[model samples]
Target: MSDLFPLTVRDAVASRQGKRLVGPVNLDLSGQGACVVLGPNGSGKTTLLRLLHGIARLNKGQITWSCPKAEAQRRQAFVFQHPVMLRRSVLDNLAYPLLLRGVPRKSAQTEAAKMAERIGVSQMLDRPARVLSGGERQKVSLGRALICKPDLLFLDEPSASLDGRATREIEDILQSAKSAGTALILATHDMGQARRLADRVVFLLGGQVHEEGTATDFFARPKTQEAAAFLKGDIVEC
Candidate 1:
């Protein structure tokens, strides 16, 4: 009864300030694996992620989950592009989610230590989280999200400010989480990152899905001109 899956979005649409942003889109997600979302600027990738994570209200259509809406909400976590740090020590920041779940502080800190090690932030556990650099804060954000052990994790440009080594560390952590049965929906413009982490791909352009398929097919045999152009590093106009 703890499982949250078979998340379905049918003809979903969203708008902000009277301007259409995303959708007339359909998406189905179940089981476990990484689904990487690829799109250029203004393609509504973030909007789509927000929509799935229950942050943004839908203007039309339906989003259904196999479990109850509240259950699904509880089983999911989201890591934003620009992470906001709490005015607390790194260790506390990482342990906060578990603490909220009523786990003892010491027990939560122990789990937080393990997650920090996974994200390569164990050395900074005693530092004030808000004083850390952007990339370091992002690491803590990811650690906090992963420590909760959600069924699905939504990440938006998670490694944007990370160095090569840090990016690899984060990717490895994501893979480990996937092996632990947590599905991932990540949005990034970094094609290399997509190639490394994606099991499936959803390519968006002009607030619409230009292509959706297995990573293999989407990269090798894109079905749409926009997708083909995007894969070939050409500008995708309209």
Candidate 2:
């Protein structure tokens, strides 16, 4: 696990408006299989991803990328719960990142097209992105993220708003990506989704990690009461 890729965090903390969203946390994620972060709402899952992506400033401690930031950023792609699309064609939207990175136009277009096909949205490449349905828009968003061939993928509730079929489609794509050697960090509340996708699980509560272990072990026998209640559909107190 350590031989392929490595990520480390030590006593990391993020605070805003007199609230500590994340704190005194220590975690290490070697680039391997998918690691799912699970917790109730307001448990700081989104903020943790942002911190790992370097989008949010850390208020304390350290996050060191053993690789270069640009390299890391290029090797990592994040898909938000509510994806934002530019007012451009689907192909153009997928091509935007590569273009900003100075990839040649022709190559970028080719890559975008390939990704569009892979995500099952090739036929809509010429359509305006804003006009797509919820599932279609999310598919395009996934394409945009994958076009870079990122080694690390951060997904914040990718299937949260999708219908059953759409959710299954996204999950299938993620499984394919995982088999292709991409390490995933997904934050989700869906227990079934987690069971299907996660190799390891990190259970967070009140801005702190409550349990971390193999998905099978964590789900079957959660070490913490909070996790136990969460899995049993009981409301947990912060």
Candidate 3:
């Protein structure tokens, strides 16, 4: 259906407990390469990702997809920072998304097995998903997320709390997904990872977008002082 391009957000805002969390921001997703959200700690990167992915309620403004709502929903997926694993076998975890999409059980499991192999966890297919190691769980999460071949994927700190090897492994999977035409909107604090993966960049500070542009230009020469400071390893505050 490939109709989720140019997803637009205007004057969007979200709040929690009477406090602004993110938004009063604007953005457009043209179904391009990976878009990376960058900021220091507590800078609303996660909130912005959630907002864009339809996880966080939009308390104000609007987020509009170019396609029909149902089609848009069907083409989208979200991967949380702390991956949520069902209390079932890894195979079952991988099959769950397909099952939700009404894929036949036998077909879903068959596809799940293939995905497990793709994510390098086929040997752990029978293991309890909840008991798997951190890296394994994240792999299963990626496998599930990719099983349906979502057109756009929202990822929140997919490499957080993992070792170098594990982080690299996750990055590889993400890269593979991107190659297969799944647009990525990712949130991260790792500058190196951002530089490696980002095609476009959105820098958030104080619950609003500080600066945004092509990753090349943003990294090479940020127009805003806050973005420059952020790139220099200095902290940014509202």
Candidate 4:
């Protein structure tokens, strides 16, 4: 695994039309485990992940990764909730990134197939990715993200719309990824999923971090009323 740690965020913010959508927050994800971002809709979880992955430009402050810019970009991967697929076969979709990275075509093909099999999408590799069901497309997107064996993987509600079996498949793949030393940063509204996969949790409310702690601690004893209410399924507002 690549060393892509010591990630530092200082006063990061995301804004749109002069309205702050997230942050002015500080965080240090300098570890080797899964960090889950928790929040309701519009609570900034998605914005935070996008900012960290360099998809969204920060409106304030800075994010620093220990690795070189090019290396870090190559070593990290992001999968959005509603993953978009290319108008091509699943195998081709998975292989495209590797090919861009200069991996030989034969090797990329083999790796893509292996990833598909691992994610239970092997049977659909030859099928057009755009035609796959939502769950299958998610699997292919995740598989494509992992095909390069990224050191850091960011997921935005990866299983939000999947059925039980599909969710479990994603969870199993995530666990395997964790075991292989990939650092996972996931954003989800699913408390159960966070409990299952999180080493630590960051609770965002009103575009800011309301609380952050170990999964056990945050779930057992949230620091803020917002967090407490959220845990109870009550809508919390800033």
Candidate 5:
């Protein structure tokens, strides 16, 4: 978020074993708030997020950010649909990252406890993270990711298979993150969730971006036939 505006991508592409999975994508993202990536299964939503986060290599294209590499790396965070937890307590899991950054033990514990409260996991702080339920683990993962106050956050199918209550909690957390000047890119097939969180929408189909526009514009009138069919709840083939 530190003047890292105008994130540029040119001819972005991703492939595996010579099979293109996502790409020929180009984007310019700036400012704060959430940018939602919407599409059905195998539409390259996950692949796109991974590629943007540097977790996956792109077969072609250039991505440039104005910020320093060290700054971006330290201020970026990613939370997956199914979060992996450590064997330690939930509080310990939250504190571990801070400890690695050289935060004092007492400060780390205090911040972890505070984050637990903020994310509605205060009661589970002492419990082993590995023993928590799926919803609880996801909450902890979100808290852990946000504990550092990241400038950019990425979420892929964050609410997949989660109950309504859990999903709402995640949405609320996203709202808070946006308010704190954290830029977010979330990928999901849930149109309702996309409507709630997106400032902009990126529609992917068959490893390509079918459409990109404001949430209001894209949802009201998708430019492509594929996007239109998708919004109407019809199945589409890439």
Candidate 6:
């Protein structure tokens, strides 16, 4: 883990309108394999990801990237449950990120085409992104994220709204990204997904970490009752 991305958070706190949404928390995320965050709604999973991505400012504590901000930004990409697409063709949507980063147009298009093919949406390249199905749109969104060749990828319920087959496809894409040396941080409530994708698990409750450990241990013998209930498919009493 130490040899990975070496991300560290020291007593971090985030606030919204003077209300503490997260923190007095400490965490370390390595750049190897996938780290899955599991929790119920309002557990601050998305908040934590925003903080780490520098999209939200920390009110207290420090988030040390262990690298320059520019390098960190270039090495990371984030995908949300509802991915936004411009009113353009799927190929254009997929090439947007690379275009912003100043990659040559030809190179961007070529790379975007390759990614689209990988995600099984190449045929939709000429179609308007706004007209694609939910699953197809997500595939395009994933292709856009991967086109950057990011070292770290954050996914906020990437398959939350998809059907079974779509969910499996997204999971397969994540696995491929992991195999390509991209560190993945995923926020999901799906236990089955955790079992399939997580190497380590971070369980959060009330905006704080309840447990963190290898996925196998956490699922087999959860140290906390809340986690145990969650893993057992029982309602977690707040």
lDDT of 4 by residue, 1-238 (tens): 3467888999999999988999888898865689999988889999999999999989899988888878888889999999999999999999989999899999999999988889898888899999998889998998889988889999999998899988998899999999989999999988899999999899888888778889889989898888888999997765
lDDT ranking of the models? 3, 4, 5, 1, 2, 6
Clashing pairs in 1: none
Candidate 1 TM-score to native: 0.95
Query: What's each prediction's TM-score?
Result: 0.95, 0.95, 0.97, 0.96, 0.97, 0.96
Q: Tell me the tens digit of each residue's lDDT in model 1 across 171-205.
A: 88889888888899999988999999999999988
Look at candidate 1 and tell me the lDDT of residue 151.
88
Residue 201 alpha-carbon offset, candidate 5, angstroms: 0.1
Model 3 lDDT at residue 3? 70
The list of candidate 3 runs beyond 4 A from truth reads none
Cα lDDT tens digits, model 3, 140-214, are 888888888999999999998999999999999999999888999999878889999999999998989889999
Q: Model 1 segments beyond 4 Å from truth?
A: none
The local distance difference test score of model 1 is 0.88
Determine which window of 10 residues in candidate 5 has minimal summed lDDT.
66-75
Q: Give the TM-score (vs. native) of candidate 3.
A: 0.97
Per-model lDDT: 0.88, 0.88, 0.90, 0.89, 0.89, 0.87
lDDT of 6 by residue, 80-180 (tens): 88988899999999999999989999998998999888999988889999998888888888888988888888999999878999999999999998998
